[model samples]
Target: MEPDDMLQTVDSVSFDRLVLEDSGRMAVEFMSYGCGYCRTIEPIVQRVASMIAAEETVLRVNIAADPELAKRYEITGTPTFVMFLNGSEVGRTEGPAPTQSAVIDAITRPFMS
Candidate 1:
């Protein structure tokens, strides 16, 4: 399926339903509204999300908006991407600095491997 890169801003409940409930999806990005890095790469994340969002759920969580959710997910940083496949945690990209292409490469790497 061809996924759109439009960034989705989700709340805690919506995030749970979208990411935890879903399986075999490409990726989800956990971010914070107050993080400068998150803002910097918002466009990149959106592009990556659009590219592979067809059958996957690409959600952006604002850690600051929902601290409990961030803590539940053990997200201690901003602009972190937690990728899953078949309801399993495959891998994650942390500390930002990833470009749009790089974000796509990271999540799709598991498929390639």
Candidate 2:
């Protein structure tokens, strides 16, 4: 997939339908515009997105723009990666990941099978 198409940005109104209601596995990065880590890890996230299967989705939620999503996800920090399976959260990494493999291992490895 194209780099731009790798991570789709989502908001509270669309979050429920796009992430929560989706039947397959979905990974969401809860981030904020002002977060340096969010920006730093963006490339890694995109790379991870490219490595995932077509059935899985990668998304981003800007906490600064949509505080409700942050609150609902109990996001305490920016760049929190949450993975959902069948509309329910299965795993999460609540900080910046150093590498693409780390991001994948933390959030997607378990669900890959």
Candidate 3:
């Protein structure tokens, strides 16, 4: 798939649906539209997601538009990634990071053997 195809930016409603009905494991990045840090790491997240898109679902949710979802996850920062497995949260990583590798590791660790 194309690189951009690896990630999806979803709305509050869709986010809920994806989180609950995703067939396999998934990771969602909670970011605000005006967050500089979130913008800076957007490409990094997309690239890493592309690398593992075959095995996982990667998404980005605009926290500003999804306050309730953010509250449910207890997200306090931009660029927070919450990973779900079988419709249940399994792991999470918060804040912006220096590189995609570290963030990717953090988001995927729970499903790794």
Candidate 4:
């Protein structure tokens, strides 16, 4: 799938169904639009989404708008990547510094390995 197609923009309202309720491995990026680090890693996240297996998915949560969700995840950074498998969190990487390898490992390592 295209990079954009593989990445889904989600919010607190839809987060449960899209991420926590999903039956496959997935990565959810908790971020904020005004966060420079979040913006810096957006492209790398998209690229990682496209590179991962088709059954896997990538979702993004705007912490600015979904503060509750961010709080639920205890996100203190702009680009926190959380990996879930079969509706439960399995791994996480809080920041990637916009590095492709870091993003890839953050999103893929838990399930891909």
Error of 2 at 10 (Å): 0.9
Task: Please provide, for model 3 over 36-89, each residue's C-alpha lDDT reduced to its tens digit, 9 standing for 90 to 100.
Answer: 888788778878888888888888788888888888889988889888998888
Stretches of model 2 off by over 4 angstroms after superposition: 1-5, 110-113
The TM-score measured for candidate 4 stands at 0.88
* All candidates in order of lDDT, best leading: 2, 4, 3, 1
Candidate 1 runs further than 4 Å off: 1-5
Error of 1 at 67 (Å): 0.9
State how far residue 33 of model 1 sits from its true place (Å): 1.8
Arranged by TM-score with the best first, the candidates are: 2, 4, 3, 1
Evaluated with lDDT, which candidate comes out highest? 2
lDDT of 4 by residue, 40-66 (tens): 887877777887758678888888888
Measured against the true structure, the TM-scores of the candidates, in listed sequence, are 0.79, 0.89, 0.88, 0.88
* Model 2 worst lDDT run, 10 consecutive residues: 1-10
Name the top TM-score candidate: 2
lDDT on C-alpha atoms for all candidate structures = 0.71, 0.83, 0.82, 0.82
Cα deviation at 53, candidate 4, in Å, is: 4.7
